[model samples]
Target: MITVSACMIVKNEERVLARCLDSLKGLVDEIILVDTGSTDGTKEIAKKYNCKIYDFKWIDDFAAARNFSFSKAAMDYIFVADADEVIDEVNREKFLTLKQHLIPEIDIIQMMYANQLEFNTTYNFDKEYRPKLFKRLRQFTWTDPIHETVMLDPVVYDSEIEILHMPENNHAVRDFDIFQRLIQKGTAFSEKLISMYARELFIAGEDKDFLTAESFFTGLLEQEVSEEVIKLIQCILVRCGRIKNDSELILRYALKNIATGKASAEVCYEVGEYFYNKDNIKEAVIWYMNAAFETDAELNIHYNKELPLEKIALCYEKAGNTEEANNYREQAAALRESLM
Candidate 1:
């Protein structure tokens, strides 16, 4: 069996820290908790878990903090998790099994990060594969100040484990503030960072921020970005146009997104929303139906599948098609029930 050290960097996470630590109690060999100026009882909570706690001064660099925490690991492998994340019983069992069978050649273990799960269905609100488990080595250091990630070798294995993130606050503005500070300090903006910065501003939804975010996203559209990122940029552009009440721009971007042949359910739903808001019931119904039936596996954001069904039901009701309306409503209800 392989020994695993659970590592984390946190501050003022007392609300969720215990939940996170409790979930890892029996799964890991050690717990390394690095506190960055916590003004709460987070350290006390860590002590309860018998975590090897160390204090570090705030440096406003997430990677530095993460690397410091990783340095304290005294096990064969490091398993990283945030203060608000948890490993459910099923995944914890799977993790133990993985440790028992893990080979020395496997440098990294990629697992699903279930960032959000739908209230009722088995559908995840948002999930992505990330390398959260890796061998303890000097060469594997985390990179990037914000949205940090490990530099892993190509020898990686995907695990059936999952880490569920349940954050109490959205922290949109707080993150945006960090990005802005980084920008002011003349940090080189990589394509990924630019995309994230634009997303933060767009989600902030301030009038001035929206204008700036729109410009940034527009600039990104012309850059050599991945198809997946292009789709996301286009989605944000569509939302920006919607905020400005520019129906022409919204339709243009939404159509472009669909033309990519990689459009997500949310992108299709945005088009449906445009037509629905304009009282074009027939056109809206087509797009809504498309969104409801979309089967793209690559889409990872908050694409509410039930929204389209409900919208189609409303469209049918407005058209005096009571039978069709009731049918779609029942479909939506059934889907929601399955989630629960």
Candidate 2:
């Protein structure tokens, strides 16, 4: 059985740190905690757990802090958890099983992250994935400053190991504030900084800042850039454009990738819903037809539970496409009838 070292990075997480540490204590051979400067009992709790603690300066980049934490591991396999995340007994047992029956060739393991799984929680599924468990010898590092992710290149397997996040979304690090302050300081900073700043603006709901972000994407596109950064900028532009309903901008970006492959069914459905909400039934049907026929069933990832077939049937009837409208209505009715 491979020994597991649980690594965590934190700052002023006094409220949630103890709960997180308590969940993983005794599960791993070692617990490594790196403090970015917490004036709270977060450090005191670490001492009680005999956790090997280190100090990492508050850098605007999260990867820097996380990478620093990973360097402190002293076991064959490393497991990372956040100060606000919890791993239940069922998942912890599953993780233990994976380590005991591990294969040498599997350098990394993908973990399912379950966000907000309360018994009565309502919303679409909050399942996201990332590399959470891996071999220390592989020397995989992390990338991206804010939502940092591991950089690995060895064979990976998706284990049923899961994690739950109950983050303090309202509270943010001081560095997040600093990033926005620097955005207005000068043009000396790279477009990367601008991209990061724009994300902050979108979250904060600053209209002018969003325009600045939209401009930054345009500015970067004019320069010679890496393919990876280009794709990121395009995605950011699409999000900002949608928020502003900038039709011209949306059409331009859509055209870039629209014909290279089929347009996204989800996007078309959203468009149809947008018009339907405005009571523009005619435009809604046109977009909905374009969506359902042109796009595949797989592309409507979470629409069934959220919008469901009955809603689609209702939209068609509202648009007065009686024949096709009735077909959808019957389908939805049959589903409901079968449930009874």
Best by TM-score: 1
How well does model 1 score by local distance difference test?
0.77
lDDT against the true structure, each candidate = 0.77, 0.66
**Candidate 2 residue runs with Cα over 4 Å from true position:** 99-106, 116-129, 138-157, 168-212, 223-245, 255-257, 265-279, 288-293, 296-340
Report the backbone clash tally of model 2.
Answer: 0
- Per-residue accuracy of model 1 over 205-256 as CA lDDT, tens digit each: 4655666556656766666788777776777777667667788888788888
Q: How far is candidate 2 from the true structure (C-alpha RMSD, Å)?
A: 8.3
Q: Which candidate achieves the best lDDT against the true structure?
A: 1
- lDDT (tens digit, per residue) of candidate 2 on 60-132: 5577888888899989989888888888999889877887899877888899877733321222245757788
- For each candidate, give its TM-score against the true structure: 0.76, 0.65
Let me know the TM-score candidate 1 reaches against the reference structure: 0.76
Local error of candidate 1 at 246, Å?
Answer: 1.2
